[model samples]
Target chain A: MRAQSEAHAPSRMVSETDELCQKIRRRKPSIYSELLRENILEVLKCSFPRFGTALAPGKLDEIASHFLSRHGAKRPQFHHIATEIVEFAHRGHELSKPLICLLEYEWILLSTEIDSARIQAPQLSGNTNWDTSKISLNPTAEIVATPFDITLVDIPVELDGTEQNYVYAVYRTVKHTVVTRSLSYVDYCLIDLIRREGEVAFNALVSAPPVQLTTDAIRQWVIEQSQNGLVICGTEC
Target chain B: MKENALGIGLRSELLEALCIQPAREDIDFLEIAPENWMGIGGRKRDQLDILADKYPLIAHGLSLSIADTVPLNVGFIRDVCSFLNDYGISIYSDHLSMCRDSSGYLYDLLPVPRRKENIEYLTGRICQVQDIVGRQLVLENISYYHRYEDQMPEAEFLAAIAEQSGCGLLLDINNVYVNSRNHLEDAVAMVRCLPSNAIVYYHVAGHLELEDGSLLDTHGTKVGEEVVRLGHEVWGWHGPRPLLLERDNQVPSLDELIREVGDVQKSIAAGDRYACSI
Candidate 1:
């Protein structure tokens, strides 16, 4: 009889647990409490692990609450949550550049992934022109120009204190793998020039600047970037 | 879907080990969470293409949030349906619990309140999803830490949902043991209460034991003896449905996972033989 009672206790306990939880749920604002906060925090930690590791104990929970208050019941977007975490770490922790770059790089991977799915790749047909000046960057290509090398974001070694301007381009390949290719300072500026001005004449892009890089060098860079599929060639007009 | 044939959850980390010592002949299929693959582009996607080409892929989604109050993300489901069609994936499984409420996704499965209203809600949603996909979806019993104020038993709720929705069951036996340990319910009784024929397959995985002696379904370790026994009992009762070994985190080497798969096959063989003798 005693064994039977002990054996039966678990079902009763389980029933009790359910009853208590149900009771708590019926009274108010729906199941909005520690669980919801933790849910948001867990998703962030799993998706953007570097920040989770960098954050001090209890800090994740704190940031999670901040996000929950803002996000309410809507599923927080990966990039949105990641951006918030980067800023949160910036205010709460040590120097901010590395963590920010880390989040940016990681979030770009996710963005490029989603971005690739939406790309319809309007086919160039009937009088297709492969002009460099007529081209545009692929939908998935994104450039990050930062003072600190974003590659060091994952590496634990200390920064050398020599923060040079660096350009990191995140792009999706034919095989769909996400990769980061670093570019020289000149290349970064030249790429930015085209993107900002939108389909400038070949000669216009190569010249007309304070940095005033040689036309030949700029032409060579354009050929190289164009070959690499970094920029779409302009249409035949 | 193969009767009594073993399956393993495909993990990227185990790819090298698999190449070195390919999975055994008894390992009939591979299971993957479609959410991880949808919108993914790169080496990982390439690897999946290769895997799908090589194996019979079954999609088990983690983010469907089928029971959530928000209207279904029809676009997301459409994306998944396309992926399944592209890969020739025949079955798609998701958890019985909700991953969201009116608010956004919780990122983990939450208990569904076991009430008639909620049952009707799941029935309507499941039927709606089936209509969109043109096939019945399988809902796995999730290992939950908290039981919502359910007016009914888990088994009864699941049975009703399946019967009304025309869905199947992916019985995760490890979840049975984990919930039993955590909540003090009888694992075998829970399994017995379910309509056995509805069990299309079974999920056996490892769990973490907390310091307080309760078990958590972490799927980060080796499947224990209790779970193995429970799986065997399932095979005996169901007369050899499919069994899948799932190791989500702390994945072991390929050899170790295969061995676990092999162990389950042997246990089921033994259990089925025993049942026949009786």
Candidate 2:
């Protein structure tokens, strides 16, 4: 009797998940991942009282684990789960609000922990003090505020050969007063240096007595900054 | 009204092109969205300043929401009026729909209920807008889906609004085609009922048809045959109004859109001469 009850539980969960998927799909025909569908339904069930009655508890976690394992995601990241919940809520899903709110709180906690870890981690470069005042935010930078863990919500659990999630992000732009293809901070420093001590060639940036630098390193940095759209190649009039 | 003239929407995207194009020669009057440049400072304002100096421009907006029960957004009205005064933009227009509610804005041009109450409310709002702007404000009929049950027929509602507001009507022929297809109404009969004397302009654009046979007013493609015919008919009755070709998304090359506008002008001219004889 116990064995039989245990076996029947999963089928019931699958049925409940399928119903929720259909409801979401009816409104927005775009979302098509089985894992994302199950995760969203789980979030809905936990956050919404009506959904809880319809779907069994712990079923959502089971489905999420299955999805995470299949998609090569760390079980803890939960970025996919968070992202899905936030996106659905953004689209005006009634159940998405509470879930998104919970997810955001969770992300704030995670970001705090990550920042502490970063402080302990070995420095990437010897010069830790970098000027960022010259860097301006891109005009199109968009910041989406949601209640849930948007990143976890969107992580794909099951990948069929044919499906993908539509990831939305805040668009931002940085403007440079002078043109040089360099990382925003580096270009900012270079411009400041030039203002302070007239024009300098590629070698001057490396040979500046206060900061030890290499010609190859400066060139690479310039290339990287240019690629990032932080630096333009001409002086502003 | 000219045979080959095509007016491009003066969006920031085409500011560079506008700067380089020999002013007073390359294109006809540029149509600007008054809301974008109104009360805005810096680069966008500077760009408009240069363009307005050279080209004859008009203001087009999306947020009038003329039929809402809520009082008009006074700030928006003042800003638009200031813009018109600064730019000397005489032809100011918005859609004949309500976009906001008491709660908040919908960010889409939603359809207004075509009821007696709505008509009265909209007419009063239009009068207020015109009085504030100090110019004749033209309202364009919008494409709609899921119309209210208590609404009057579209033609009767539009004709009533025109008569009551004493404002010019911007007859959007493509929207009529979309609504006609969606609701299975006679587009020609609807066109005939419009107050011909009040029509200030005509608009033509593309629409997308969904799998369920419902039409979406996408404005992202070429104008259809039905819209062209409706445009010709409107020109036949109202004489030649400034016919603008509106393509917001999926816009083809300027050459292609200009060609389409050229065909429309030819048809309008032919229809105008024919109607004059009668």
Number of the top candidate by lDDT? Answer: 1
lDDT of 1 at B275: 20
> For every model shown, what is its TM-score relative to the native structure?
0.76, 0.56
- The residue-by-residue lDDT of candidate 1 on B172-261, one tens digit each, is 999998988888889888888898778888888888887889787777887777787787777666667777899878887777787777
Across residues B1-278, which tens digit of lDDT does each residue of candidate 2 receive?
35335566655456766676667444577787664555444344556778888888868887676655555776778878887888888889888875544443323455666766555556666877887888888988888764555568888888998888788888888899999998999888898888888887778777787898877777777776656777777767667777787877766655565666666667656643211110
Best model per TM-score: 1
Q: For candidate 2, give the DockQ.
A: 0.03
TM-score between predicted and true chain B, model 1? 0.92
Q: How far out, in Å, is residue B263 in model 2?
A: 2.4
Residues A1-237, model 1: lDDT tens digits: 000111111343334434433333332243335555655677678766775676558867776765544333342233344555555455554445665666666777666755534232333444443343454565578998666666664433345567776787787654455668798777677777777776666666756583576767766665667656566556436
Off-target runs (Cα >4 Å) in candidate 2 are: A1-237, B1-6, B24-26, B271-278
Task: Evaluate all candidate structures by whole-model CA lDDT and list the values in order.
Answer: 0.68, 0.56
Determine the TM-score of chain B of model 2: 0.90
